[model samples]
Target: MKLQLLSDLHLETEAFEPEPAPGADLLVLAGDIDATWQGLERFAGWPVPVLFVPGNHEFDGRAVEHVVPALRGLCTRLGIRLLHRESWLFDAADGQRVRFLGAVRWSDFDVFGARERERSMRAAGYFMRLMASTQHGQPFDADAVRREGLACRAWLEAALAEPAAGRWQQTVVVTHFAPSLKSADPRFGRQPGTASFCNADDDLIPHTDVWLHGHLHCRHDYLVARAGRKPTRVLSQARGLVDKGEAEGLDPGKLIEL
Candidate 1:
């Protein structure tokens, strides 16, 4: 199957010209497409199947509990699938069946180690503070964000271990947060307190054939070698815009064959 990958459109501020590949089987929007729910309509008339995963910006100035359900409802009405701790199967053109497992995958502050976590909480005032002020009339504290991350991790682990996971000819894992440190920008990963919220633990790296993620505004496509399993390809296609409304000129969009 040929799948086109795009992310971090931020359409509220930047303009996007969708260049869909001819005969593309699917289009995956990694995250941060827009801040408000109305921005989803930009993708309305596409011909191929659409899959989406929400990013932190989706909940900006809105309650997470409310925005999530509203987005899901809108997705259902539009025939788009919004994945969160969920799985779906697609029949490929080559007569092979492919499975997709996905989640928003929040940051647990564990990627930077214990000492960094302590310093980040002290210096950066905990990662949740980044979103606390954005939430509408609701208390989005550190504890709540931490608990949500824990739940996401638990769900992903359990979902990967299901017997059905081994039935697919190929498996792809999609997330809105960076799952491997290698996929993150070197400059951001070296920062003091900002790195923790930019990545996830590498525990799920071995189970997927292709790891599709978008959080760090950089694109990565490389084989991650593992112990006993085949190398997994990590792809992040984020067309990040600068202050003057121009692309960062990095990896913008990618077409992957599975």
Candidate 2:
């Protein structure tokens, strides 16, 4: 099936006009479409099935515990599929079946080790503070964020281990956070504060045929090879404005076929 992947639209800053390619079978909103839930309404009338995973921005100024259920209800009402620690099976006209596992995978802060984590805490502590103060007006501790990331990792590991995982001809893993270091902008990899949040651990690399992720606000495509597994294709399409000049020329609306 032809899948149109989009992410980091940040519609509040950059409006999104849904002009899917001809014969586009499905639309995947990887994450960060907008900060407000209402932004999703813009895509309601699209002709194809829509699937989404939440981005970190979706939780901005809102409690994740509350926002998640609300987003699920909104998706149900709008006929959109919200994939959170879940899987969906789609069958193509030609009888090929593909499975999509979706999650808003958070950074485990293990990308660069303890020194980077300390640096991130020192440099980006404001972000953690904002989340703690505003999340449901209850303290959303840093430990909680780390726990959530670990939980997502555990869920993915279990999901891939399931016998059902073997049935699909291909498995596409969708996440808001980059799963591999290669997907992250190389310049940011060693930065003090931003480096930790740019990637997730590479444990999921072996199980994915195609990894769709956002949050970098930059587009990338590369093949990642893991021990005893074939190379996995990783793709990201983000339309948000980036301060880095390297991402200035990327076409955010690019359509990718899987």
**Error at 199, model 2, angstroms:** 3.2
Compared with the true structure, what per-residue lDDT tens digits does model 1 show for residues 1-258? 888888888887776766676767899988889876677886777788889988877876567778778999998888888998889998877787888987888766666776676554454455456555334555765545555677888988887777664567888888888886777676556565554445555767777789898877767788878888789888888777777433566544456988
Name every residue pair that clashes in candidate 1: none
Model 2, range 1-258, lDDT digits (tens) per residue?
Answer: 678888887776664565665667788999888887778887787788889999888887777788789999998888889998999998866577889999898766666777567565555556677544345456555555666777888999988777764577888899998887777665566665554356555766777788899888678888888778678889888766644443476664466677
Q: Which ten-residue region of model 1 has the weakest summed lDDT? A: 244-253
lDDT agreement of model 1 with the native? 0.75
TM match of model 2 to true structure: 0.89
The per-residue C-alpha lDDT of model 1 at residue 216 equals 74
TM-score of 1: 0.89
Candidate 2 residues lying further than 4 Å off, grouped into runs, are 129-137, 227-229, 242-247
Clashing pairs in 2: none
